[model samples]
Target: MSDYILGSHQPLAASYPLALVDLDGVAYKGHLPIEYAAESLVSARNSGLALVFVTNNASREPEDVAGQLTGLDIPTSPHEVMTAAQACARLLRSHVQPGAKVLVVGGAGLLTAVQAEGYTVVSSTDDEPDAVAQGFHPSLGWEHLAEGAYAVSRGAIHVASNLDLSLPTARGYAPGNGALVGAVQAATGVKPFSAGKPSPAMYDMALEKAGVSSALVVGDRLDTDLAGARAGGYHGLHVLTGVNSARDDILALPQERPHFIARDLRGLLETQPEVTRENEWFICNDARVRILDGALNIDSAGEPDELDIVRASCNAVWSFVDEGGEFDNTSIPHFSTL
Candidate 1:
């Protein structure tokens, strides 16, 4: 909340009543569990901090998502999960009546959600559907996207789960739901309303489902997870376990910067030290960083080399950029946390 990393004397796991955790990056990447994710989450739950696994991936249902985490040794219930598919359906209710015909442009997860919300699902635009709810699924073909485009062109209100441009896979990054949604937009020349991260749709649902006033949004994507937190008026904790790196975070846009940065979920169980500005150097414990003659330099490599260096560097760089300081992007070195 302070312009950069905020210190917590108490373990972050017990600091807030609820945590709206991002699934892919924070808990697990794809189907594999991140290091210490299960243990740290279990500890937080045991300590009475409730958690809701929120995700922009609308391909899977909450039950499936919960099952995936439970198999990873992170014991979870379906009620503890929230997906963008569910959020998309909720968003539809505001624009159309319950039982209104809707075109679902994704897979079973989205179809099931739209139906559960009492909307009649239609596959084609000829059904004269009232709205189109679009999400991502791997089996999607050119035909599906064309259908969404046509439906929207006919004045069906278009809504998508999220605008994420890419999806992560074992083989590397692949096309995400947003990429497909872009095709529909290009065809219709009308942008779809996004109901995923950076829009606060899922976060709003998570808050109501958890019945909490404030929450900590944790994730690896700055554009979606962290940006959503800022938009929803909640604190964000950026974890360097997926998608984004420490340097990516150090130079994050002001609107997407996180309140806390950590190596992993273990940060939830650890105290974060203060990053202070003293003269030209930004200090975090023994770590210090400053820009000298337009060259960013680490004056000191603090204890826990990687963490402290990142913390110090973020404060120094963010402060510099915000104060109208300019430097070449390459001048900022990337500190590897892996």
Candidate 2:
């Protein structure tokens, strides 16, 4: 794998056969569609690229998630959605019998998935379940977590649909399934095997469902989406529509850097500019950046495109850092420039 970001001479929609898209941040935030998300996705689909919505969310059934998309003016179907619940259920099938009892500590989506895999869904440790599956649900309380802890303490294999630390809500960030999983871990001293992003399981299932040889993984978060793509040996495109900002992205660790960065889904239509080394500088579009005496330097103010500046900065910074060089914050670009 290359340490540098990947480039595309052609528009991403034409270069890749499919796109595995993350939901919350990339497609929408809360109940509203992100700016230009619906239009870009529609355009990408029209350009002959299959779009599969992949999410770490495990609380809602596929149809319900699809309905949310459709409601956002983005035409979608349940078949086009893939959830962490599915991956968790698939994982459970390997460790248990065809009809083993599974204690559920989440909501309808996770419950439905476990049952779909031919497992009996139970609600408590008293049932002596063969395994325990936990996910996010607003109704989940201390009692449910206690049940998961109790079940896991009894030697039941624990699986989490996802371990996302926070969930975006209408108000702000709220505790996600990972927080609940942490509570269970503290009580039972067992860390549940994660089945979502940053794990290849969900992406593997998504690739199969999309049935494409080449795909681009698109999302807002680097740790889950980009890191997951790197783990799965696929190209990743980062969008700045949610969670992480351009400034945050440029400073990401090597393993979490995306192959491409964009302002939004609209990036699908544009050719990814190449960041090439020239003398002592790395250039993208018109922006040029270089490291000088342990500090980063902007050799030229060349581009009006904000994304290009980020791209150029990432290339320069990453290239230096990967080579065991230290960063000097004096050269950091203004946040607004990013």
At residue 38, what lDDT does model 1 achieve? 96
Model 2, 1-338: lDDT tens digits are 25566678899999988899999989999887799999999999999989899999999999999999999988999999999998889989768886999998888999999999999988778899989998899999888888889999999999999889999876778998898899999998887898899887777887787676668999998889889988898889999988888887778887788999988999898899888888888777777777899777776554446677778788888888888988885677676743
Worst 10 residues of 2 by lDDT: 298-307
Report every candidate's CA lDDT. Answer: 0.87, 0.87
Model 2 TM-score, 2 decimals:
0.97
Worst 10 residues of 1 by lDDT: 298-307
TM-scores, all models, native as reference: 0.96, 0.97
Candidate 1 clashes between residue pairs 3 or more apart in a chain or in different chains: none
Q: List the residue pairs that clash in candidate 2.
A: none
lDDT of 1 by residue, 178-293 (tens): 99999999999998988999988788888887888888899999999999998988889998888988878877998898888888998888888888888898888888878877
Q: Residue 318's C-alpha lDDT in candidate 2?
A: 85
